[model samples]
Every structure is written in C-alpha cells, then in structure tokens.
Target: MIKDFNEVIKSRRSVRFFLGKNIKTSIVKECIKNATLAPNSSNLQLWEFYHVINDEIKINISKSCFDQPAAKTANQFVVIVTRKDLWKNRRDFNLNFIMNKFKDLKDKKSRRKKKNAVNYYKFLIPTLYGNFLKISGLIKYLNVSILGLFRPMYRQVTSSDLRVVVHKSAALAAQNFMLSMRASGYDTCPMEGFDSVRVKKLLNLPGSAEINMIIGCGLRSEKGIYSEQFRVPFEEVYFEK
Candidate 1:
C-alpha cells in the first residue's frame, strides 16, 4: 500500500483516459465522506458532491463538458458544487449542534460559548449572506474596507467575494476527495471545462448553486497520463516575508 502521503499526492494526476473496469461504489462513497472532513469557512460546509453512477447521466454530463476525453472516458463523475445560498440552512444546523453541545454542560463558560455561537449564526451569518440587487454586499464591502483602514477587519464582503470563498472551500473538499482516491489506488481528473448551466439543470440543483469543478474518476488506462508534471522554479512562486 502507498502509505506515504507525499507519494500519494505526487502520484495523483489528471488522467485523460480510463480502463473499462468499474470501481466499487462503497469505496468512492467512503472517499467522499473523507471530503466532508476538509476545513471550511465558519464550519458552514457550503459544498455538495453529486456522484454520477448512472450510465446515461455520466454520458450526458460528458457531452456537457464538450465530450473531452477526460470526461468522455470517465467511469464516474464527482461534481463539486458550491451552495452559498444555503448559508441560512447550514447556519441553523450549526446553531442546533451548538445548542445540543451546551445542553450537557453546566457552567457559565459553556453558556457564554453557546451565546456567542448562537449570536454568530443568528445575526452575523444572515448579515453576511443576505443581499438585494447586490447592493447590500456592495455596502458591506465598502464598510469593511473602511473599517480595515483602522483595524483588522474581515474584508471579503461582496457577493462575488463570497462566491469565491464558497468555491475555495468546495475546491478544498475536492482535493481531499482526490487525495483519498489516490491513496486508494484510484485515478481522478479535475476538469473546469463544462457547461455550468446545463450541468446545474442536469443535476437538478438550484440556480443559486455554483459548479466548483467536475472530477472524473476511474482506473487509469495504459496511456492515461498525458504528460510529466511540471512546475515553475520555487523562487518564482514562493516568498518568505
């Protein structure tokens, strides 16, 4: 078994071709469960994974991706989606978890903890997520930018900024899923080339939900790996301050 995490990470590649053999559903699902453990903003976990197992659906999705070899030849697909509009639902879930957590404790500190947690979900999340014609996010962005001048402030406030934030967290989850698959001796290819609108409709997801990336999963074929890995020199991209 490839026990070394570094080796697993290094071995993972965007395989464009896959073998005819199929992978077990249970194994893929377990890797998806690992994806949920990825760190996310405010513990909201505004991400959803759609595992496409149906023959017709995968083919449809492949076409939506322009019938690229990566998607066309994939045995299955793991579609990562960002659900920023579900913030209220996730916030309430977090509030419930926090409430249940403090119920067993009998201390003033615990009460304070519950109060802060409740306030964050009840007040702060709505303020950050609620928007009208993008004006509210605009105002919030300006306010944060001004506040940041005097002190450290959370400046990511606009709707576009929040979109990026949710997508980033979803991408992190996708990475976790990919790494877990690599460790399990499976291959995956993360592809951004796709018809987002058609994909959303195909998946029956809400319009508010955004497609983060579509990952192709299967066993690599004889010539699946298209090229050797390449990277810029460390000095060009890395800096210590």
Candidate 2:
C-alpha cells in the first residue's frame, strides 16, 4: 500500500489540459473522502468543497476565475471554500476523530469515565477552552493573522501566512485527490492564479466562506501542452531529522 501510494505521488503532475471525458461520481466521492481525511488546524474541519459538474456553472466559474482555459476544459472541477465562522470557532473535522480515538482508549476503563470524557469534549466549556489554548498558536497564525484585512493573500508566504496555512491544508487535500485521480487513470491541475472575491460572488459564497483554489480534473488530451520545468533537488529542498 505504501509503495502504491508513493508511486501515485511520484507520477502525479498538474495536467492543465484535458480530454472530454466524464468522471464517475464514485471517483469524486472517494477523492473527497480522502481530502476530508487531510490534516487541519486544531482538527477543525473548516473546509467546504464544491464539486461543479454543470457545464453552465462551470463556464460561469471559469470566467470568474479570469477565464482560465483549463478551468473550462476540465470534465469537472472542484472549488474549496473555507468557512469563516468555523475558523473563528476553530472547529475542524479532525478533532472529532482525535477526541473519539482518545475516548476509545478511555472507554476500556469504566462507562462513567468514558461518558465523562465524551461529555467534557462534546459539551464542557473548559475542555474546549483548554483545547483552544493548546492549539492557540495555530489559531493565532491561521486565523487572527495574515490576509490584509483587505484582500486574500496569494503567492509565496508574504503577508497572508494564515491563509497560506489554510491553502497548504487545502493543497494537501487537492494533491491527495490528484494522486488518487492519477492512480485511477485520470488527470488534474491545481491552479493558483484566480480572483478570490470574484469567485466567491460567482459561487454565491457566504460572507465567511473564502475561495482558495480550483482543481481541474479529467483525461489528458493529445493536444495538451506541458512545459518543461525543473524541480529542486532533494538536497536543496529538505533536511534530515
């Protein structure tokens, strides 16, 4: 399983151009499940993903994203939206898994302790407060900071460090989806350049929801154009533990 996953990771690439091939809903669902399994700040599952299959809606979104040809060409596209309310509360989906894992370990003891632990996390204010303090750094950096209180920050790090954290999480999810797609004989592109506000408006997003990036998925076409870009060597990009 590890070898297969590594192979998928190594073979996956950004496929900007695609063939007119429809992806099965099952595949999309599987990819989304994998994406939701991605790590998040405080186990807070702040992300909301939209799978756009309608041609008209896709066309409108494509225009909103500056008419990127790849956006329109994909058989299907996925938009990642981050909920502001959820971010403010610091509630991510992973937290539930974590709490449950701990609860299971505790359940081996007594029913009373198991119930107490679950209630403490599920309702107790102090437990939540403690959890908040533990992951406070993540909150301060991922929410309270970055993004000029004015616009969404993109590019390398820069001012939107918080947004970058969310983007990194979303990007990891997207990469996981892409690798799964590749393993299933599909293609994908992780696009960064886009107008976030315009995209939000086009998608009728909530005030708290932020549009991060779009992923184009489909089959590669014979006419697809791929640029020859060099990736940094391991020595230049990593350090031993």
Candidate 3:
C-alpha cells in the first residue's frame, strides 16, 4: 500500500549507468507479477518478457540497439516481444471497442460501402491475374487488384482481436513493473530504439513474436543526470462536461 503515487512518478528515471550491482531475482519476479495485473484490450495479454542477464547477451542487445551505451550499462534488460500471429486479435478488439462506444453508428452503410469499394479496387484485381499481366510496371497494380477483392473474404472469416487486447495488456504490465520498481527504490527506462530483426535473431524468436519495447532496470549511477520533462496541463489533456 504505497499512498504517494506522485513520489513514485517523480523518482522514476531512466537510469543509464550502473554499478555492476544485480537486482535480486525475487524482486524482479515480484515486479513482473505486479505488471501482469495491468488491464488489456480483452485481457489477452499478448506479450512475452525476456530477461537478459548474461554479459554476452547484454552486449549483443546493446549492439542490436545501435550500440547505445545505456543498453550494455544497465544491470539487466527486459525485452518485450509481442506475437504477430495475435495482431489480428488486437484489430478485432479495437473494432469491437469502437462498436461498443458508438453503438448507433449512423454512417455504417457508408463506411461499409467505402470499405468494400477500397477492397475491390485495392486488393482483388491484381491477385487473380497479376502473373499473367505482361506489363512489367503494372505488376504491382495487378497484385493490388487481387488483394482488393480478397480482403472482404478474409475480413469476414477472421476470428478474435487478441493482438490489440494483448499488446495493451502487455504495455500496462510493463508500466506496472516500472512503477513498482520506482516505489521499491529503483530506476527504469523503457526503450523502443532497437533493431528488431537483430533482436529477434539474437533471441532465436519464432516468426510469431514481434519486438515491442525494451525496459532496463537497475540502480542509478552517481554521475547519471536527468532533466525534468514537461507534460501538458490536465485541463488540456482531459475533457469533461
């Protein structure tokens, strides 16, 4: 029961340097467990966390991140990977959420008509006979024609919005981990700056998993400096009747 949420928020900083001190495994586990409690689109939780602790593994991650000094300097790195196969689930979740919010969609017919037209013109035509087209420059056009037609067929049969739901859930979990770390007297950094392909290869990940973001956790170095960033006032960021 930490009461002062602002204290945690103020204390949380991107700690780039470390003192070779390791955060206990139990602490990490607890933090992760707290993160899993974060809400998601449909509670799909479509994310996996990889903890990199070995020196060589850390070095490789740093290299994949364009050789940023922070990557290698942190005590540990938590690599966040989302599943690509589950992205359709996310899309479905988003669609459903939209429907829920606007149950009386006055322009449903128009929207569907536009969607259908785009599908036909963009995806269906070229797919069916693109290879037969001899016009070298029009090959892409032919492919688009086929895709336009097939989009409707694919869209109708798709199942679940697991990706959107899961990624949102995963991000919530990540945020919890960061907040918990700060509350427990630790510093954390969320990083989206990395070569995803290289990271996937390094982790030997399956094609289904997509790299989302990396979070590093550790004690801050004495020399590390940070500036207070600004945020839009609450009145500007929120709306109420």
Candidate 4:
C-alpha cells in the first residue's frame, strides 16, 4: 500500500503507454468509491463514473478518441460524466438527508438551524438551479450585477455558469479517482480528446449528461513517461495574500 501521500501525488503522471498485465476491476471500483469523498458544489454530487472494461466497448471508445495511444493501449477506462439536469433530484436528496437528520433533535437552536437549511434547499436552491434556456439566468445575472454594485452578491447564476460548476465538481471527483488509483500502484491518463457525442451514445447516456473526462487505467509501460516533467516556476504562479 502507498502510505506516503507525497509520493503518491508525485508518482502520478499521464501514462500513455501501459503494460499487458491485467488490473482488478474491483480495485478500480474501490478507487471510484474513494472518489465520492471529493468536495462538490452545493453537495449536489452531480457526477457519474463509467468503468469501461469490455473489449468491444473499449475498442469503440478508443475509436471515438481517434485511437489516441493514451486510450487505445490502456487496459481499462473510466468515463467521468456530469449530470447537470439532475439538480432537482440532488437537491431533494440533500433536503431529505437534512430532514431525517434533524427530525429527532428537540433543541430550539437546532430546530432553527434545521429550518434555515430546509429553506435553503426548498427556496434558495430552486431559485438558482431552476432556470430555462438562458433567459432566466440572464435576468438573474443583470439583477445580481446591479445588486452587487450596492452590496456583495453571489454572481455565478447563469446557465453556463452552472454548467461550469458541475464540470468543476466532476473534475474534483476525477482527480480523487486518479490519486486513489496512484495510491493503489496503478497508472492513469485523463483525456478529453474523444468525441463526447459518440462516447455518450456508446454508454447509453442521455443528451443532458456531459462527458467530463475519460481516464485510461493500467500499469505504465517502459515508454509511459514520454518526457521529463516540467512546470512553470512556483514564483510565477504563486501569490501572497
């Protein structure tokens, strides 16, 4: 087991080449379960993972990716998907969790806190997540922008903005999955080069769902490390508060 967190992080790389050795699907699934521990916006958890190991499915997916070496040669694959259309369902889930959790508490302060949280899921969430086309979002944006001129306001209200929110959450889950894989002595390469439309069809996903990233999974081959790792100087990207 990889006990050193630092080593696990440092050892992870986009492995484009993989050995022929087989990896246990159950291990990968456990890694995915670990992925659910990642933080997400609104606790909505608007992500899904598809573990693709079937040979026929893998071949088709690789073709959708233009047979890129990263995907074409990998032993297995995990497709991260964002389901923004399920906002209401997720909101309800949170609400249900809150209700069940707070139902037994008798303290007045706890009751007040529960009421506030209930209102958040019942009213505030619907206000933000309930939108049609871009019309509602555009109106909310203009209203919020004007309000912000006077006082602090939550500005990310547009439909596009919400889409980005879902994508960001999915990315967090993807990173969690990758790190967990690394901790398990597996290799991965996250790729967005695939035809998302075809990939979704192959997976039988609805049009409302979006493919966040496809991660190739296996043990690294001799040629896996294509080049020396490089990054911009820390001083260039770092900032002092």
Candidate 5:
C-alpha cells in the first residue's frame, strides 16, 4: 500500500545499511517516472536518471562512492545527472510542443499566448543558453547588471549560473524520486561522496554532464538509520513576512 504524503516525508531517512532483500526493478522505474513530473526551469528537462541494476556496474559505482555503508549495502543505485549541454535540443522540444498545442487555436487571445510561448523558446532561451566559450554569458551578465540599475531585470545569465539552475532542477527530481520510493514502501539514501570522474567514465557520460547525486535504494536494515533526526529549531529556520 502507498503511504500518506506526510508519512512519506517524515519516514524518509538517510539509510546507511540495507537488507539483502531485493527490490522490484519495475517499482523503481515507476518512481523514476514520477520523478520526471517534477517542475523544472522553463520545462527544459535537462536531466537524466541512470538506474544501476547490473551487479558489475553497481559494484564499480559503489567503489566510486568509496564503498560507504549506504553504497555497499544497497540493492541498487540511481544516478541523477544534469545535462546543461543539451539546452538547444530541449529548447527545440519545448518550442515544437508549444507550437503543436497552439496550432489549431485561431482566437486573438490564444494567438497572443502562443506568440509569447514561441518567442520564449525561440528567442529568450537561445539568448540565455547560447554562450560562446563563456564570452556570451559574461556579456549578457554585464548587460543585465547595467539594465538592473534602472529597472528590475533577470540577472542569472552566466554559464555557471545556468549550470546551477540545471542541477537544482535535477536535485528536485531526485527528492521526488526518494519520496516516491518512500511512498512505495522502499527506502533510499542520496550520496554525493563519489568520484564523479570514475562514475562518469563508468556510465559513459559526456564531459558536459554533471552527477547530481547517486541514490542507494533498498529496504532499510534494522540499524540503517544512525540516529534520531535532528534540527536546529523550527523557529530559527522559519520566518514570516
């Protein structure tokens, strides 16, 4: 049975050890499917998930992760990746999708909406993502800074900034994947302590691709959780307008 949303959130822990019991590959795939529904920047969807089920590959990945207990004991691994290099392809995909959706609408309001969406993918995205050896981004950043002095302007135009944006989206999807796994009566531990170079070579990922996180997945062992959850204090973190 699926779990309630609050229960799923509260129950999730950074499981350090998992039982030898195996989890269903199909169920993990379903959780990944749910992950894709996560909201992203401009709907670019510049992310990929690698479900490492093969024992050989999983072992190599665990080695890359320094064979931490979470990595060594988990039944499987899910690697989330950010593909900032694929911006053009994703831009065209959204462009085509939006165009197709609005193709049949001839009303004035519909046409205006279509034009705005079309221009966003066609013009704005290219301007933001089409950097020439980082020069373009620098120029765009300077331009935005100058314009911002006079009026409110979008500023995060540098290549590094965009990379952060893509990774943030991937991390959001990773959270969704973990929560979905919890809801399905499974567990996961998101691990960043890995050799990105080795993991990329193992996965045959390109240089422009980035490893967001590698999640260890399975049924948590009795001693999987190290300690009770801790927090500074809700009042310290929460604020009101």
Candidate 6:
C-alpha cells in the first residue's frame, strides 16, 4: 500500500547508507513519470532524468560525487538535468498541442484565447529564450530595466536568468521524484556535492545542458539516517503578511 502523504514527507531523509537490497526499476520509472507532471515554467518541461542502473556507470558517477556515503552505497542514481537549450522544441510542442485542442472551437472567446496562446509560444518565447552570443540577452535585460521604471515588467530576461528558471523547474521535478520514491518505500538523497564536469562527461551530456542534482536511491540501511531530523523552529520562518 502507498504511504500517506504526510507519512511520506516525514519519513524522507537524506539516507547516507543503503541496504544491499534491490529496488524495482519499474517503480523508479513510474516515479520519474510522475515527476514529468510537475509544474514548469510555461509548460516547457526543460528537464531530463537519467536513471543510471548500470553498475559501471554508477561507479563513475559515485567517483564524480567524491564517493560520499550516499553515493558509495546507493543502489542506483538519478541525475536531473536542465535543458535550457531545448526551449524552442518545447515551445513548438505547446503550440501544436494548444492549436490542436482549440482547432474545433470556432467561438469568439475560443479564437481569442487561441490567438493569445499562439502569440505566447511563437513570439514571446522566442523573444525571451532566443539569444545570440549573450549580446541579445544583454539588450533584452536593458530593455526590461528601462520598461520597469514606467510599468511592471518581467526583469529576468537574460540568459543567466533563464538558466535559473529552468533549474528551479527541474528542482521541483526532483522533489516530486524523491517524494514518490518515499511513498514507494524507497529512499533518496539529493546531492549537489559532485564534480559536475566529470559527471557531465560520464553522462555524455552537451555543454549547454546543466546538472540540477544527482539523487542516490535505495532502501535505507538500519543506520542510514545519522541523526534525528532537525529544523529551525517553524515560527522563525513563518510570516503573516
């Protein structure tokens, strides 16, 4: 039976040591499918999950992670990647999907909505995501900065800003994957302490692609969790505005 949502959240920990027991690959794949349903900026879905099951590849990835306990003992690894370079393809996909959905609707409101959606994918996406040698990004950033003085304007127009946008979306997917694993009686550790260059090379990823995180997955050992979970008091972080 699947665990309750609260139980899953409370049970999840950064498991540092894993039992030699194996986890079902199919379940992991299901969790990845759930991850794809995570909300992303403009539905671009600029993320990729590399589920490393091969022992040899996992070893190399563990080396890239400096053989941290989580990496060293993990039964498998899931690498989350951010693909800002694929924005154009994703935009086209959204456009095709939306156009097809509204194609049969001839009402004025439907036509207006379709037109807005088309403009968003065709014009706005290119304006924000299209960049030439960083020059265009700079120009767009400057344009937004000036426009903001007169009215509300989206200022995250540069390439770097867009990179952050994609990474945030990918991170959300990562969280979904981890929680889903917990719900399935598996554990995960999201690790950023890795030699990204080596990890990318091992994965044969392109230069434009970025590693959002590497997650170690397995059934936890008895001593997996090193200590009791701790958090800053909720009162300190919570705010009422």
Using TM-score as the measure, which candidate wins? 5
Write model 5 residue lDDT over 1-241, tens digit each, in one string. Answer: 5888899999999999999999999999999999999999999999999999999999999999999999999899999999999999999999989988889997999899999999999999988898766477878989999999999998989989999999999999999999999999999999999999999999999999999999999999979999998989999999998
> Backbone clashes per model, in order?
0, 5, 23, 0, 0, 0
Q: Considering summed lDDT, which 10 consecutive residues are worst modelled in model 3?
A: 153-162
After TM-score superposition, what is the CA distance of residue 163 in candidate 6 from its true location, in Å? 1.0
Candidate 1 per-residue lDDT, tens place, 162-237, comes to 9989988999999999999999999999999999999999999998899999999999986989889999999999
Instruction: Give Cα-based local distance difference scores for all models.
Output: 0.92, 0.68, 0.68, 0.93, 0.95, 0.94
Model 2 segments beyond 4 Å from truth?
Answer: 1-3, 87-162
Report per-prediction Cα RMSD to one decimal: 1.4, 8.1, 10.3, 1.0, 0.8, 0.9
- Candidate 2: the clashing residue pairs are 43-92, 44-91, 44-92, 45-92, 45-93
Candidate 3: where is the Cα deviation over 4 Å? 1-3, 84-165
**How many residue pairs in model 1 have overlapping backbones?**
0
At residue 79, candidate 6 shows an lDDT of: 99
lDDT of 2 by residue, 55-162 (tens): 888888778667676776888888877663465255434345546666546444665766665564465322323334656545544543455465763223222444
Tens digits of lDDT, candidate 3, 1-241: 3638998887777766666678776677678778767776434456778888778988889888776656766778888777645544544564555556655556988668556644543444234212333453254544545787867332211123334544566677788889988777776778888998899999999976878778877877865435565678989989987
TM-score of candidate 3 against the unseen true structure: 0.64
> Candidates ranked by TM-score, best first?
5, 6, 4, 1, 2, 3
lDDT of 6 at 223: 94
Stretches of candidate 4 exceeding 4 Å from the true structure: 132-134
Query: How far does residue 172 in candidate 6 sit from its true spot (Å)?
Result: 0.4
Lowest summed-lDDT stretch of 10 residues in model 6?
A: 130-139
- Cα deviation at 217, candidate 4, in Å, is 0.3
